[model samples]
Target chain A: MMETDWLLGFAGGLMIGGAAALYLLVNGRIMGASGILGGLLDGSDRAHWPERLSFLAGLIGVPLLLAPLWAPETHLTGNPAVIVAGGLLTGIGTRLANGCTSGHGVCGISRLAPRGIAATVFYILAGGVTVVLFRHVWGLI
Target chain B: MQRNLFALLAGGLFGAGLLVSGMVDTSKVQGWLDVFGAWDPTLAFVMGGAILPMAMAWAVARRRGVSLLGTPIPARAEPRLDHALILGSVMFGAGWGLAGLCPGPALAVLGFGGWGGGLFLLAMGLGMVAAPALRRRLDRLPA
Candidate 1:
């Protein structure tokens, strides 16, 4: 009854965890997603530039690289305007919170930071609300 | 030991992985999984790319190697499957499925100047800052 999407979730978690681990292994940092983005905002991230550049490169480049063999026309279905709006809001959230789910949920919580744990909870609740507004209330989904 | 700093380095690599893996580009991501159009499976391959480095790192850490940042590598911990984790995951899934942007990929997108990345990053930040106060209220309830 409570079958988990273990495979997908694990892979997702693995990516996050692996990145954290790898970051720790190489740079000796926690890989907080928000912090990385923060540095990008102020242009103060010397230690993570190459890594971030490579990571960002990999994010889009990887998919593009695999396009020849995989889905080459990968794009979104929603209104482009909606997506831009969403991305903008999330950026603002990251700045105000000083972290994202990856920072608090994946990395901070993993290290047993009480604040991270708590923040992670709230993050999910907000997501749930968003879905309800967009999907259930607005019938967008 | 500057545990915080070590975490910083690890984060950078994690970010790199997210980038190279195309976890940030929602359009490409939606394109990859889009059923109506060109259903791309590049996400699969990008995920595959992580194997080597992760394996190498795991082995080295397992053998008691110190990270380049001088922190003592610890054993990998299994993620706890609890209510909190589950709840957080569901939220992540909801946002990802709806916007096709996770925190890692979203940030990566910003770096690469992907379309809509700015908006996604903004909401993500807002959600984070509000988490603490929201959590405080949740704590008042009986578990």
Candidate 2:
């Protein structure tokens, strides 16, 4: 089961990388999910709104179309406070940092960019520590 | 027109990848982060797999200088380390640990994630809207 899961993950990663490649090669954009969405929201990338909207349409629409077949599950927490807090933090953090997992973790590190590498390390470390604290010590989540 | 079409295709591919890779599963994400517990290392494969093609893409991009659509490729980002990167990352990490959902998956899961997903998305949008003001305040503080 674990092996199967790992294989699936790898395959999916390949698809993600392929998508990034396509976006960069064809569109000349970095394919950062947060930046793509945040730009629209903050009015920073209004000039490229059509492209961003086109991208988001597929991002949301494909999954919506596939949901019946895939039955994707988030298994998110039931706690409203936790959910809200998590959402807010993720939003603010990603925007402030100007990237997220897709941007910094995948694209940034792949290109050997220092900022991407540093951001990935810090976030992963912080995530580990948070898990230890919240899940282990606090048992809050 | 070609740019929009390709962008849509890329987005579809990305969304599919998130679902297939089990990235939409909050438990899988939190479990991977749970290093001291029954940690799931599958995400490592995903990360490694993703980096492979992107690395090649970067190499090709360096030589080409422009996309196939004739748009200038974005320049490499500055290497400077600053307070915003570190601080925002820590906050993002904490939020990720708390909910096991990041930006991409958060949006991707909206179709089937039910009310919880909707609420999270709403809050996330609100936070994004408010971030600029907060960022201005943070910039004022001595680094």
Candidate 3:
């Protein structure tokens, strides 16, 4: 169950890349989820809410519409505290860093931007350490 | 209208890609992170697949000041490797390891990830709302 199919993953990643590319060419925006949603929530980019909303509507709404067809498995943690802690960290951290996997990992790395590359490396390394600490040492999760 | 349509299309495609790629699965994400245990390398391919076309897009973007639709290409943020960037990334990473959910997959799985997913989204939204003030406070602290 833990094993992932590389072909599907690659194909799907291609779609994600295509979407980012399309977003860049057409809307002239980086397709970063945290940035897009954060801008709307924090009122930093209120003027462009319409475009953001349209984009999000498709992002969330389409997955829901297709939920029956794909029914993707999401192995979320059962602990309420873990869930809350995870959410808060993700929210605050992404905003503070000014990007997430999409902005820094995909878009930033593609452009060879220093910030994106550095952020990507930092987050992934941090994530690995966290996993070791929590899952291996602490066994909290 | 056209731009909005494109945005919609792009978003839909992005979400679909996440779903198809098995990224919406928390176990898959966690599995990739579990190097000490059984590690899954599918994520590497996903990142690679995404970077290829985006690299091309960036190549094109380098030549033009404006998008094909005539809007200015949004400038990249400052490249400075500041404390905030490092601190935030570390925190985000910790959270990611704990939950196996990031903002994108968290949203993508809302429909299927059930009540837990909903709870995570709500909490994350609150955190995002609180972040500006947090950053301001952090900035005021003696360096």
* Per-residue lDDT of candidate 1, residues B75-117 (tens digit): 4334433343344444554455467676676655554444455
Candidate 3 chain A weakest lDDT stretch, 10 residues? A1-10
| CAPRI tier of model 2 | high
Query: On a 0 to 1 TM-score scale, where does candidate 2 land against the true structure?
Result: 0.98
How do the predictions measure up, each by TM-score?
A: 0.55, 0.98, 0.96
Cα RMSD, each candidate: 8.5, 1.0, 1.5
The top-ranked prediction according to DockQ is 2
Worst lDDT run of 10 residues, candidate 2 chain A, spans A55-64
Task: After the best TM-score superposition of candidate 2, give how far the Cα of residue A73 lies from its true spot, in angstroms.
Answer: 2.1
**Candidate 2 C-alpha error for residue A110, in Å:** 0.5
What is the DockQ for all candidates, taken in turn? 0.16, 0.85, 0.83
Candidate with the larger TM-score of 1 and 3:
3
Candidate with better DockQ, 1 vs 2: 2
The order of the candidates by TM-score, greatest first, is 2, 3, 1
**lDDT (tens digit, per residue) of candidate 3 on A15-124:** 99999999999889999999999999999999889889888888888789888998678878899999999999999999999889888899999999899999889888
Quantify all predictions' global Cα lDDT against the true fold: 0.52, 0.90, 0.89
TM-score of the candidate numbered 3? 0.96
Give one digit per residue, the lDDT tens place, for model 2 in A1-141: 999999999999999999999999999999888889899998977999999999888888888899899887788999999999999988999888889999999999999999999999988888889888998899998
- The best-first sequence of candidates by DockQ reads 2, 3, 1
